[model samples]
Target: MENLPYGALAALVGLSGGLVLGLAARLGDFCTLGALESSIYGGDHRRLRLWGIVLGTAIAGCYLAQAAGYIDLSQTLYQSVRWNPWASIVGGLVFGYGMALAGNCGFGALARFGGGDLRSLVVVVVMAVFSFITLNGPLAPLRITLFPQIGAESSQNYADLISGLTGLPPLAIALPVAVLCFAWALSYAPLRRSPRRLVWGLLAGLAVVWAFVGTAWLADQSFGEVAIEGPSFTAPLGRTLIYLMTSTAGGITFSVGSVIGVMAGAFIGSSIRGLFRWEACEDPRELGRQVTGAALMGIGGVVALGCSVGQGVSAFATLAYSGPVTLACIGAGAVLGLRHLIGGFQPG
Candidate 1:
């Protein structure tokens, strides 16, 4: 008896996700662009390092939850065996480059948007539209023709691939590697000094992790047969766009719900904190950054299948091997964009 209101389950996952997102967005002031801004301009490492902690905490928490029978990790979208490494890795690299170009990762894009950065709205739209086109829009056929992936019979995990590469058990590699990453990020002295920001960072990161685990659990319960979906910005942005255009055909996804919730949460938090700035861009340069960044995010997200927070951090924390690969590639691309790609876009 396949009697399940998966739709409601999807909404529940979204609600829980929004609860956590609202709390995190308000408390932490978390954003990849903000982190980069701090690193580049303020010489502060607190935010960036906290991002690492957030991911680590979430990964640890999600895994523990799964081990404790609180959730089934296998039910999520990422767990299904699908072949598309080029789409993931190469696309991740492009996405990362876009982040550099866009000046914010996925989470940062949304966070910035909520904080009254109207430019971020442009970025979000480009990201959503591009993702839709690639996922199932005009370019869908091109994806089918060009990037035909072949995954192992029932898995798309890079952990298995890592084992083959290094001849170590997947867990053995994943654990030590993740731990090392945590240590490396926290090792930065400036980041260690800002205990307050660090705490907020930890809270935000845990929220990101919790959002996914909580959703997976709800998804499982909703269908009475584990259904897996995680919190991501890309699909939700697309969903938000789609719902606007095709209201009757497809309903909003959990991802979109999380995004909307985050916005509301951020807005609420902003109002309480007196941080709301309902202003638009007067600076053309800023506008350019927003638009360019948004387009890059759109195109890059399509290739990679998610944004920095979506696939890289959130997805990777699930111990999905491709998640890490996407993260690395995205980072690499961002570096390149920052290094060589800024001058071309003139103020418009």
Candidate 2:
């Protein structure tokens, strides 16, 4: 049974995720950072609040999924406390700033690719490559060398800090608070007026969360089956690149499946909606933004161990102690970038 053909199964899950992403992209137009930025500038509450509503739905869906036995989140890697705590927060901050600059995060970049955006192509390529470099390329040794040497013992992880502060199990405080915060965010009265967008936003949010949960599950089924489960990008991106370079005895990797499915799904969904617009950067400054944003995302993603979708949404719903901390730092970083570099880009 262990040797059974699970490759197709894995691909199917990945394809479903991509289709969900493309459908959401073509439908809801949800991206929190972008939506927030747009709101700040245009004073339009539609997209911004839609982002929040999506988040609320994602949180609710995640909890429901876990309760339904779709995922035993305790098996997730986020619970492991061996890594540097400061890294997640610091990395999230930098990644958030970079996301603002690139005008997209990991998921956002993938969604934009469906729209035939060439500038995003550049950003995604650089991000994937640099992600490889940081996780395993020439930079790997340097990361191992610098990480322990830089942060204090106190810089372990957000959960450690929370446990220290509240004297309770991290999950005890994190889960309840996350649910409450999401509920408050979604309860914005004006947003309830548009039921169509509300339904789309909720579905989009669930699609993203459950997609990763499925990825982790697929990975577990790939071999003799391991109990450990996690959804992260830094190492997975590097591994996916390596898999592309050479075929080996290692099991099927879900990241590769997920990445491929997004392109295919985007192609199909865009064609269906007649929203296929091939885009390129006309302004030279846009090129600079892409390069800078890509580099920042690569480095920051490695340090934080995830992009926005990975940490902010996916990991957060699991009630992982680090999730909230990383999200807050990421948001703060985005706020900083908007204040200093892209002040003209505001969120309503």
lDDT of 2 by residue, 138-254 (tens): 887886676543323232334436768889764454456556655655677666776766776777667666665675576566542432333344445555556677754344555
C-alpha lDDT of all candidate models, in order = 0.67, 0.65
lDDT (tens digit, per residue) of candidate 1 on 1-348: 236455545655675666556556656666665566577657887776777777766676666666667766555556654646787777777777778767776666666567787776777788788777777888878876877544446545655567788998555655665676678668988777767556766666566656666566655555544246566777678877777678633565566567777777777767777787866778778677667666667766766656777776677777675677777787777766776554564424
Model 1 residue 312 lDDT? 65
Distance from true location, Cα of 100 in model 2, Å = 2.2
Clashing pairs in 1: 54-205, 75-228, 76-228, 102-293, 123-294, 127-298
- In model 2, the worst 10-residue window by lDDT is 148-157
Q: How much is the lDDT of residue 298 in candidate 2?
A: 83
